[model samples]
Target: MENRRFDIRKSLLRALFASLCGVSANAMATEQYPCKPAPDEGRFAWGRIQSIDPNYLVKRILGPYTFKIPYGYMIGRPTPERLNCYPKQNRLEFAFWMPDFRAPKKDMWSEPNYRVHEPGRDAPGPQEYVVDVVGLEFIETKAGKSGSPGRRFVNGLALLRKDFRIEETYGLIHVVPGQNTPLSDDYVSLSNEGYEILLECSRPESRDSNPSCKAYLYFTDLQLEAVMQFPADALPEWQKIKDGVRILVERWIVKEKPT
Candidate 1:
């Protein structure tokens, strides 16, 4: 009886140790790739404050899709007037810092000097990119029945041209016909809201040695329209940047295992 009791205590100790080790492993994994789990339906619906982690990998459910947004990406906070929460069907606005971009330790989303670029004072600041994802319903409102992705893209270009007065203004257009013509299919050069924007209608064929443009892309693969804004100088490596953004979006999606 005494030997049996000793064996039972040994087994219990082994089980406890194993459990603690498993927990430690999980904690380490979380530290390496910290991600906030999906919020409950009630919390999402009520626009309640969920986790307070600065490096939040928010999980959002929109229609048929579930997105697990990674860290360095800022999720749109819900407001009293505009409750931009989960299970949303219309539009969602989010922003992300490029992988190379170094974000602040805290309040990265609301940092005042995020866009400031003052050489000598400090290191070069990375550009901030904003993206807007809209559903078919929102697209229908913008462009009528023939609101195909191609059509919407064309319309966007037309709107930008008209609004920026590209024809009327000189030097507004960055490309100089034969001098600095971009390798990309289409490039729009204009300044809006204090930022010089270089819009790309489609992917580029090759990288330019002295590419003089940022990037704005319209993606329709998510069953929703996604409009992206990034620094224009990155245009030379547009394909890589495009791929990176696509990868980020793809990673966010929670894939289901085969049954």
Candidate 2:
């Protein structure tokens, strides 16, 4: 395993950006971006926050969802250190564990020294990306611009791609442009850490005007299901993950396979 301290630039950049300017009361306006954490049921864009992190940017992808999040926060353990809350009502919870950003690829998710894993129905995917947390302004997620996140607000994505050592970028760690991208037929794929994670979305089959199922998320590692519904008291913390995935149908990339 590569030492976490191998990256010196990220630390230096954090120190440099911390002095630029503090967020003001006007920039803290709630109406700037109307982002209420509720399921739109189908595809849509999540609100954006102009976090003060210069090295970080908008646009993280997971399965059918693509939304802006604070940079440097990797797919953490299923237990979220920060945004952790839910009511008993048809609640949904999601957690992702990102692999160390540049661990050499050697089929760790399949034939590790301790265990031999299988992809089950889906094939193994590219290794995942991970990062450590320090001075992140991502916590102050305020109102953001509506509609598809424009390139201007999402400026940090390019920096991440240039600064980080990424391989086979997938899901939240891999920041792809646009919401809809071409994907494999399989909804599940393996990641770098030798664990099976849900990688794609298969539209639910239904003919009725209103389908019987509501969107729910699965924690691939724990094999736990969070059944979600729009309760009266649902908070942003509860609906963040579902909103990310639910919005994918409205917009996506649909990339072509390499020749």
Candidate 3:
């Protein structure tokens, strides 16, 4: 009986040790990602409207899309035209489509014969609009791999993990308007000049291999959340203050020192 009891105790201790080790592994994986200031020299154009003609605000967000980069994660951005199809290669696209809220101009997608333009120019379909993304924050959620074809939610990033290995990252992005451009699409005539933009990033559903996915994507994070900041004031004339606030945003990237 004593020997049996000793064997049981040993098994229990072994289980406890195994559990502790699993927990430690998860913690270390989380710690691998760190946040730092983004490079301030990247360029961004608003809806592709002739590059903002050298406005102060346009100059600021043009900087690199630097918010935070996890050690093993990838990243990408969307062009003005690709915003419609939600480009699969370069950027993850999320849409915060509010039913009651109206767009500044017509929906280019709704247009009978829409034509997308190249980068460095706005879509010829609607009035020009600028979005001032003051700050960006990312949140990661671990979704176990069960081949369940999990349900996706807007404004959330998905971290695909199996046996603690982060296999995939999906992100949702949100963008708020900062300036207005001339009307080219009908959706632009809505009540306001601004709208919230949400973008989702993940593996292309049609891709066949990991290399194919990487060729088209910026990076991979099991899940990522982009927290875009706007100004406290809701002034109708966001464009007027865009230059000033944009410059301020450049200084607001995340910075955390490794311990």
Candidate 4:
């Protein structure tokens, strides 16, 4: 009877140890990704790496996405009243979509699940606007891997398609040169001048090899989708800001185990 009691105690101790180990692993994973700050020389755009509590961020928010901007630009806390200030200067801001409170199953999906939006109508069709209303057409990139068939999202959808001149590509991310350009697409009439670049992760349904990514992509190990924009007709020299843009984002590398 003594030997039996000893065996049961050992089993309980083993279970407790396993639970602690799991928690420790998660903390270690969060610690592994550190914030990297880029230097500001007053010539080109300036950006700094910052951190936020994972719990305070959106349900899926994994890390920080800094807004890279020029020397004299003013920064403001995001609000409906502050919308006018963005166009006053070469502005950079972060956007967060409200969770779908109406439908529980569609909570993680950024867009309203039951509603369908199109260019002229409010209906889901062949090119149904399944994604958010702002930039529905561009969410699913045509450049996804062969078998994966996943899509990528560019933040500030209206700015990307109309205002910013998408100049180059750093891997899958679109690099927007800071040049001010005329509105080419008639779809978006709001912004007349700006610059922007986008970094997007593969959507869950895309069959990508990365298991950590999903639709409501805040759970990914890295900063999956982000956009930096500026109010300008002509972009300043690129040599100063390009490195800052790349370095600020590189800090968020995909982890093997997401927290």
Candidate 5:
């Protein structure tokens, strides 16, 4: 009888431990996105932005989907004063910042003499790139019969071509300016990577614009789209940037186990 009573107690203890663990996990999950939703304002309902640690895991939920972003990334509005928030017109927008693999240097000499004297020291070091990711819950009205994410991507490309008069010839994409296109004469040239490319600079006529490229990509896996702005000079490294962005999105999505 004593042995049987001890076994029962052990089983109870195991159940109690499991329950505690489950509660702890749930608490952590709730803490991921600590913003509180406010009443509807205009078209969007603002969420109170909190002073969160940069290393904190951020979470975003849309309909039946949920995304959990790991540490070393940042997400927020364009400006703190901006009242725009999610669930606006069935779309969500946010800025994401991640480390650039090409720019691994975090520290550098600040002395002007050192910079001037050292060869290749005056050259600028790569900095973290910010990408705007927009989540669309509904299919675009113009993207007719975009049954799959891939079709949606094609539709996006078509729209860009129609609006900007982009021409792809001999393995190169030439951005030909249209009547309303805010592009200079061949200001943006890109090799097609299956993503929409645009000018990243504010002034397309300036010399700085030549080296920058703004790319829009549709993520089929996540059923979302992202706009990445990076130096066009690093066109050769487009594959790395694309892969990194994919990994970032993949990390955010929560995978469900088969029942």
Candidate 6:
């Protein structure tokens, strides 16, 4: 009887310990992103404007977002990072991660070996081009401007052309200028519904060297108020989504750095 009682006590203690561990993990996960820790939900606001670092840039909340560039830094852009409509709020608090420009040699960039497309999803089908973090900036409309025009950008995770498929999608991007060029006073509108970013691989201008692997970015915004510089390296499935615009991609951003 005493042994059974002791066993019951041990089981209860184990359950309690597990519960405590789970709670601790939950707390840590929530606290990780706050600019500062808070007992409850934390709020993020606009802060400082940071310069650009060629090596590094912004990363998604849970992303395998790492770049080939040697170094990088996050910048605080002008737009709000999170804009919610429940309360009809448009908060523009942008930020970025950049490299240490001062140390040139220390900043080394490398290109990873990735196929143009994944094994299962071949070309002709929808391809995905993901990045660590991408943003759209709105260029101001001048006096002569009229209705807004849009731009298009795309990033490809894998690009499969006629010949052998490119294993790792690198610098694979495509950009389509808006209907109205910079010459127009009124061009600026990433807010458009059709605006998108895509990723694909194409034969480089020169067949001699390594096939020109690129990341294509298309912006539907009339005036690109946002300027996004992607990391040279990315994960297999790193993606971004905008609920307002209703844009989705197969490529995705990983929650953590790649192995």
Q: CA lDDT of each candidate?
A: 0.43, 0.27, 0.26, 0.28, 0.43, 0.29
Collision count for each candidate, in order: 3, 14, 49, 5, 1, 86
Per-residue lDDT of model 5, residues 1-259, tens digit only: 9999999999999999999997787577555543354553443422222233334444455534555553324323321233222322344444343344221121111211111222454443344443434333422324552224344334445545345565653233555544445433232333334433333333445565224555555543344555555554444455566667677655566743222
The true-structure Cα RMSD of candidate 3 reads 22.6
| Model 4 bad stretches (over 4 Å) | 1-22, 25-225, 254-259
**Residue pairs with clashing backbones, model 1:** 213-232, 214-231, 214-232
Worst 10 residues of 6 by lDDT: 83-92
The 10-residue segment with the lowest total lDDT in model 4:
185-194
My TM-score estimates for the predictions, one after another, are: 0.42, 0.17, 0.19, 0.23, 0.48, 0.24
The stretch of ten residues in a row with the least summed lDDT in candidate 1 is 129-138
lDDT of 3 by residue, 150-246 (tens): 1231111223221221121122122221233111100011122221222222222333221110001101121222222121122232233233323
| Candidate 5: stretches off by over 4 Å | 1-20, 28-51, 77-172, 175-211, 256-259
Lowest summed lDDT over 10 consecutive residues: which window, candidate 2? 131-140
For residues 124-143, what per-residue lDDT tens digits would candidate 4 score against the true structure?
43322112211101122235
Q: Give the TM-score of candidate 3.
A: 0.19
| lDDT at residue 21 of model 1 (Cα atoms) | 100
What is candidate 1's lDDT per residue for 157-221, written digit by digit as tens? 54442223224222334322333333343444333321222345323435543233324443433
Question: How does residue 186 of candidate 1 score in lDDT?
Answer: 45
RMSD values for the candidates in order, in angstroms, are 13.0, 23.7, 22.6, 21.0, 9.8, 16.9
Instruction: Please provide, for model 6 over 132-199, each residue's C-alpha lDDT reduced to its tens digit, 9 standing for 90 to 100.
Output: 22343332345443222222221111122223222223222223223322211111223336443343
Error of 4 at 254 (Å): 5.5
Better model by TM-score: candidate 4 vs candidate 6: 6
